[model samples]
Target: MGEEQFKGVFVEEALEHLTLLENALMELEETPDNMELVDSAFRSMHTLKGSGAMFGFDVLSHFTHDIETVYDLVRSGSMKITQELIDLTFCAKDEILCMLRNDYDTIPEVQKKKDELTKEFKDLIERYRDGGNGATAKGTLKKPDGKSIPDEIIVKDIEAPRYTYRIRYRPCTSCFLRGTNPLLNIEELAGFGRASIVAHMDDIKFLDEYDPDACYAYWDIIVTTEKEIDAIKDVFAFEDESSEVKIEVIDVSGELDGGDQYKKLGEILLEKGDLTQDDLDSVLGLHKKLGELLVEKGVVNADIIEAALAEQVHIREEKKSQQTSVEETATIRVPADRLDTLVNLVGELVTVQAHLTQMAVKRIDYELLNVAEEVERLTCELRDNTMNIRMLPIGTTFDKFKRLVRDLSKELKKEIILATEGAQTELDKTVIEKLNDPLVHIIRNSIDHGVETPEQRKKVGKPPKGTITLSAIHSGSHVLIRVKDDGKGLDVEAIKNKAIERGLISANAELSDSEIFSFIFAPGFSTAKEVTSVSGRGVGMDVVKRGIESLRGSIGIESARGVGTTITVKLPLTLAIIDGLLVRAGAGSYVLPLTSVLECIAISKDEIDQNHGRELTMVRGQIIPYISLREHFFINSTEPVNQQIIICEVNARRVGVLVDQVIGEHQTVIKNLGGIYKNVETLSGATILGDGSVALILDVNRLVNLVEGVERDAVKRLGMASEMSVCE
Candidate 1:
């Protein structure tokens, strides 16, 4: 309805188009011959160019046009999509983002960069066109079977009788410098067909202080022309370069006189009682401007005044609608903050509904209980809907690894093949956002450190190109993502010696193969002889560990020398809520993730045995290492004659935790500890129970590591113990 509102819509549509461009570029990297990806890329660029002009982004529109031309060739099958083309498109997409933000002056080098990229794109297309490729031989680009690809493919065909053209004319701010009357150009165009000039007053300054010579108004014209589209373009041929003009042809065949435009105008006139029904019918038949005809026939009051005012709003909205259609196809762009706010509101509704259900059950009121049950059902549905809104396919993140592998393999002079599977696995938007960097780090490590050189692979009787596989799948309530490289794996003995040499562990440290392999995740632990840019300063793996931990996730590694290494990360489906097993220790509540809990047991004082100051519990003939939560957190309480032990597993290692009481399962809403407690270990995060008490979530992996480390230290002291004694 207004220029400001129209501009807002345009901005949103531009963002949507940009996202499509990014996704298509990534897809094109894998399916270089996919005509659909090519066509979609071209369409996104074309729509951006059209919408940019409508919203007064002249430089952006002009710059995007060049890249669109290159894509147009690919879309028509005149040129093939290659890595070079996709890379150049990525550069162009970055430039478009700069233009959208009006950061042109700050990025003076942008034009040069764009020119260079476009030249590269043109050269690649030309190479394919002149290389005697099938595309070049046919004169016209042809499909694989030799059918000539058409210039434009209409996916949907519909019939329309009349076409409506929307014309937007925005003059340059410096138009007065050339002594040009923008209105004269508008008038010249109106002469070709029946046209209405709606002058946009949104940009008009106060009349008393306005510069009469300075053009402040833009015109939106709806011109019905039987002539071809070229005729409309020719009207402003002289001023086209200096002014912004957009023309959209809307086919309105099956309707009675076009749609909303006619209906709105009729309703406005009827409400004002400008003309009787008979008068309106005659004016409509005469094909004259309705407002002018009404005044001329003495049907009502002021004719020129109201018509111009009403026409301006109608024309602006029409232009906006046309631009919107060009930019956005099937999806709408929404701000991240808005989505976050919606999520928070949904969470609050769930919390409140839970409380209501609790109260309903306690009161034993049948009517209230029914209402509470319905509320619970609706709240669950609403929560799911919100979560779905934040779920994005993992394919997008996985696609980036292709480029990484290509570049790193070339630099290292090694042949590497990256294979991806189960890329359609979905994750929370926040998780995906944070996952990108960690995934890149892991893949880079695989290419630079894990994968062997071609010579070594050949010597090992393996293929020259080492294979690295990235896969993701839903495992229970968590997602399991694996990055496996088929090359020389970690040497456990070597890692143990390296750790001992670095003073990270004692020389006498006796550890299992898995424990030794995990030492790589320790800070400042690196076995590399020299540090390089790729990885192996021992920096990124630790960061990856911290990041996974921050998400309440776990990371583990499994490897065999001369075979391969598989690094697996387990993450929850949603971070907003979790099913937790609540327990009490030291007058406070703590939660252990239900997913990791194995089983709980109540052991009498006789059941617990102490050996060398370490506690152990015999559970079904298995000696499970046990830790007392009261002692760990410094709770000064006498050990109960009968204490409960909660056995949990982390990375397939079991440990028993002694607690005062088992609080059963809880629906946990995770709440972060304050800045002061951030460095505290053995706790991943804190959650609020239904009773408003906070329960700290146990970091099971860290607990297992600590307990296992103690066991290793104890074993080291009994170096000369017999085999049977070591096993005991």
Candidate 2:
């Protein structure tokens, strides 16, 4: 294989191992005494090192060796896990990531970081080993069970009893071409204990028939080890179908005469598949040792019989580990664009079927109508199935925040705990991808601006560690995500003052609590007294709001002066399709995201005139503001005498939108608007109706804000009009 092909595969596997290492380190922090965690961490580093070396990342291999040694010490209980050690591990993890990203141009910087980390690790180990003693001493370290580790060596083969095993290893002629190095496997097996190798050359062809690239040699071996049978198999983890390895327990549990107990020459040859059982029996009868007779008969070579005191297929049938044995559901990785094309085709199918069903409804032929109805049902199911394939669990995104929270908390010298719930909630993969950045900003804002210092928290009788919770739940057709922080919350008066000072709000203007909090999202607006690296420069929350809205979602903020704050974001389950609340206003039919529409009510002409053109109306004793779509869109068509009120949640408030008629719910496939209509407000996108008409999707959030701006303008005009009347 080409270097590039193996490079990508090696990188992918290395990343997977690194993730495992990080997870193990995190768990070790919580349970410092868990030896399994230490072993897991060590194994991850070991695999990464081996794979890195095989893939020609020698720098990576060498650098990781030092880090791996630290974990080896940890696994042997010669070192301990401290905050400093875990911190260094995380730094090392980041460095390994950099290496994988091939920051080779910065090799000096990378080497410098590697040296610094290794020194820190050795220093930390020395600190624990010396126990602050001024004088150095060398002695065996005893375990908690009072067993002393031999002073002559470190951990390997320490406690477990050694058992000698005879082995045979044979490899495919083309194994090296596929990147399999049997020597590497043999070298690793040697790490277990003392190993003796005998090269068997019977498989070698004559000079004229020989191929340089073809492997013609096999091996018979003997090894004494304390490791498990599985550990021996692990040495050949990269073995493929063409390779053959057989291991037998000739001497286990202290069988002293292990050499004499090994399989005889004919039996060894039979075991390697070089001879049949009947051939072995016949050969055994001919000579005491088969070597001379086999060579005379030209049946085999001297080397083949010389290594008779072999050894994997015996252990091949050994039950695999639970982790490996479980049946793996087969899957194939296809390009994402192919799945998207499949969805698009399914979407077109739905559109066509909708047209067919509509035509069938108007026909009197029952048979044709039934077929159309069935086709519509199948199309809907297909659309749902196709869309479901794009859904992914949000937990993968949530898991990434642990590192973020850890790093930020350490950098700021604050103790913060990230609490997450409902991470199993799934959303369209595209929506989840876009949600990541906005969520990061929100969490950063929570940490930088919202959460109080540990000292501050304790003074207020709260826990020393502040907590930021991220939660998601399926609510109807939307996912309700909340980022809540238990910290000293927003000061309304301070926000109002800052808003007025920045010209975001007028002095002496009366505003609700929600309105005061909304000022934080105004561009270039901040209540922060000074800028910090994290978030104080006013570049965060406003962009967060805009990003959420871009996904056809909405953000709402709730805060208490001294208690805490919660920012709730409502996102559509999918961006590709929506259950739309279709409505008609003037000449155009519009699609409102069903998740945004709460209810539809009637408005009477008498009530409209009673209000005398005021845009506020009473609904069940509550005075809610309303917006007129005809005026907003600048439609020349006359308004309907009796209009319907679509009550929608805007900025977490009940706002009514007036439309000519309610066309009911629809399964609308969203299509983006062209560049020409990009700047238009109160219109998000468009969708195709059953009759092939284009219905614009309303931007409910923006529509409500527009009406509020108009209301403020009208109030100012009326006041000036009243003053002029009095002056006259």
Candidate 3:
């Protein structure tokens, strides 16, 4: 890979580490005594610092190192996790993201933020050094067992008592694929103090049989350092489970008997576990060296003997020293564009499968039909698998709102808690990405307009800390995301007055509370008496409506007088493909989503004439309102003698769509109609048919809404006419 590609990988990995850090910090705030959370945060920062420096992100590495130190203190129990430190770390995490995006240390504004955060972190470190603010004394460090040890033992370069450690490291065969370089780890181990390393090359294959991507050689490293055993363990902290590592303190502070002799070669080999005691004793009687004797007797491999010999010599030289040590999970990240391409290819395959099916049905060959059926089945499975790859749990987006709710509630001086449920409900990446903005607006509106202040809430017999529940539940092929708040519900009287004042609805117009509440989504409509930073400009709900509708989703609001308000957004599982009912109205073909289709019933022009201008029909003693696609789209054609009313459920209401024919089911691959039809709200997108014809996908909810809007205008005009006549 090129330098740029390597840096890109680093950026991606660093951002992920930052996310982990952010989540851990957020949780730490709730449970300050949770050492696991502190450890988790520390690990992420440590990785970021190490990887950032390796990837040439010097400024990011430096800034991270300081923060990592504070976390290290917490990990050591030398400092307690405080709200101030958590907030500082959160700010640092944000700044690190900025640094990563701006090439680390570039961009004057980001640099300034870095400087400020660096100062704060340094202050925390100083506080720890001075044993102030819940920090331990400067001269002591906490051990794993909570015992205070002198600080000199923890410092690597200090001239204090040290230990000599022998480390055995064997990398996994697939270690290279995971981007780990064992040599780098060995080099890091050498940095602690005087060191000697010997590679055991016995596992290497012949040149012709060699695999470049596989690590065949293992190592035995001997290090004499002032650092403690934990410091040595950290050198291999990131190694995966497939690799093997064992670290033991061979000699402490180079202490030896008056003879200045280390453990005998045979005993060292035995202690190193390279040979059993039987093998050591059998070789001990030989006149030649024990290592040479063992190799000749085939009792131990030449490489193992060589490593043991190396360890023996090194430890004898200084009377030397010591050294170290740690994926539970593995993942390969592919760029999103690649997954998008795969989804598009799968969609194309679905379309081709439909064409083959159509051709087989038209032909009389049974063999061809069977082949087409098999292909159809395979295509369906392939389509589902490809879509599944793009499916992400909605919890990722939910987690982001935690920080948002925290900041916004703090700014608004309202004590509110965000509660989420069904966060694991899965949705297409496309749908999830588009759903974010709308959900943000809804939650913001709820916090600003829906929820009352703590004082007001208490007076109303509600808890001071209000709760806004964000939840998702899968309903067949659709996902319903509801943002509900236990606050003062939307005021119908206020909405009614606003609608009339804005000329949105006529005074004294008979409307349901649902209809009245919907006026909040009108452009520039607000019930707030004044505007604030959080909301009240009225753009939030309007944006929410447009964003949801653009995703071919429907949103509805339900509220009680003093209880609460719930905004429900219903979205399709995926936008790439859908099961739709193909229908024809005049020359135009349309596809109604199969999930929305209830049933189709035959209706005639005679029945329509009985209802006259009402366009309402009696279906099993129930009044069913309908929209004629032919009249709505202005398709010029003679009315069919036999018509069908396709019953569809839209926004929890069943409505019928009049069409000339119901043409079975179609697997629809939706294609955008481009900018020309962008503003056309009634139609979502268009799809290609097996016969190579274009069929428009109907937005059932929007269609019903458009029809209701037209009917409402008619009623308003009629009411005015009746009033004028009475006056006359």
Q: Which should have the higher lDDT, number 1 or number 3?
A: 3
lDDT of 2: 0.79
The per-residue C-alpha lDDT of model 3 at residue 667 equals 92
Compose the digit string of candidate 2's lDDT tens values, residues 1-728: 69997898888888878888877877777898898888778777777887899999987887777677676666555677777778888998998888887666467888788788878866765655544212122223455676655523433324455566777889889987887778888788778776767887767899999998888887877777778788887777778878888886655544434232334567667766666776555556664457777777767777666666334221222212211544564456555789888877887787788777777777776888899988988888888888889998898788778788878987888899888899889899899999999999999989887888889988989988999999999998899999999988989998899977865556889999988999888787787788878977889898998899888888989998678999999998898878889899988999888887888889977888899888778889999888888878888887778899999998778999888999888888877799999988778889888889989999899877766767677776787799899999
- Return whichever of 1 and 2 wins on TM-score: 2
129-198: candidate 1 lDDT, tens digit per residue: 5544444432335568867665344222233233446676788767887778887877877776557666
| TM-score of each model, in listed order | 0.65, 0.68, 0.73
| Model 3 agreement with the true structure over 564-638: per-residue lDDT tens digits | 999999998999999999999988899999988899999878888877677787789998888989989998889
Cα RMSDs, all models:
19.1, 17.1, 15.2
The clash count for each model shown is: 1, 5, 7
Error of 3 at 73 (Å): 2.0
In order, what lDDT does every prediction score?
A: 0.75, 0.79, 0.85
Clashing pairs in 2: 167-311, 168-311, 245-312, 246-312, 247-312
Backbone clash total for model 1 is 1
